[model samples]
Target: MSDSILFNVIPYAAALVTLAGGIARLTAKEPAAPPSPWTPAGRTVLAGASIVLFLHLVGLAAPRAMQVFNASPARLFTLESLGLIGALLLSWGLLTLGLRRAREGQWGAAVAFALVLSQVLTGVYVAVALRWASAWYLHVTVPYLRSLMSFQPDATLLQAAPLVIQVHVLASIALLGAAPFLRFGRVPARTPASVEPGLLATPREETP
Candidate 1:
């Protein structure tokens, strides 16, 4: 019962919240302002996050291909190494962002940063502790996520996974649920090559 609630029920609930909140955010009227610029840390975070998200999506989209890709020992190690590097980069950016937010007295945003950082840390731990993450992810996480997408939630795929992995998955879902409500401030426009690093501060205006 508990497993069903946690894996099956919670994911759907979070998805609903994310869907509704996203629509509301899109439909709301707000004055447009000049796009702010991305800070160095923000760029770092975006780059790292994009890499990690891309890999995950690729795996989910082509589990069979990923399995074949990981069949070689060298290839598997290389893939895992890239994942760890991305995680490290993400951690570095989050640490910078969180500290800046704290210094600015944006406690809410800082707290959100902490939650996200924890999620990232847990993923790093999973990658390190559970060898061959990409291979196993295809077996466990991908199927489960696909199940959720197909409206056939199967908690069993995760029931046997390590507790940390389970926590990481659930925490990610929680973040998705809370995404719309998190007012972390507007992301600045893309930093141009000519922009001085010193001038690339986050926008002062917080998004409602």
Candidate 2:
């Protein structure tokens, strides 16, 4: 597909699905038992996600401020370093969570975890191999995302980005599009009944 359709068209569709899914999840009836409290892996994932998401949101919403922040070499290094740390934590948590889900036969959750793990891994590689991404991100990615938000997506800058960066962006969009069904749309596994249906059968008395 063309870059225009990939970057422009896909993001809007993903965003719409994410928004609708979020609303549906909020209004959906509660399960008989509430979801279990966060496990250690879950907490780790949340912590890392908080850091990573906060930085991305700020960069997207306030590019000029990010530019100013990245202008200082020391500050830029710190930002990139922190981002890498968050990525590491995210990956570790995903590894544990994915394995556990796979072992339990929760294939749907396992797939979600695997996709997210790949997404986080690509992001980590981009931050390292691309080096100074915190600085350059303000120039290309931030603007591309802003244009997307404004309904005037221009992939010109993104087209010029490295293949890995392009893959990272595309993966994120795909994940977003899938969030409704894969993430928020999941249902709890059903437990087996205490008594087997076959065991409940009774023999009829012989006719006199």
**Which candidate number would show the highest lDDT if scored against the true structure?**
1
Estimate the TM-score of every prediction. 0.86, 0.83
Q: Alpha carbon lDDT of residue 68, candidate 2?
A: 90
Clashing pairs in model 1, backbone N/Cα/C closer than 3 A: 36-188, 36-189
lDDT at position 170, candidate 2: 88
Worst 10 residues of 2 by lDDT: 181-190
Q: What's the lDDT for residue 152 in model 2?
A: 87
Whole-model Cα lDDT of every candidate shown, in order:
0.87, 0.84
Q: Distance (Å) between predicted and true CA of 150, model 1?
A: 1.3
Q: Mark the regions of model 1 whose C-alpha exceeds 4 Å error after superposition.
A: 186-208
Give a tens-digit lDDT track for model 1, residues 94-140.
98998888887888888888888999999898888887778667898
RMSD of each: 10.0, 6.5
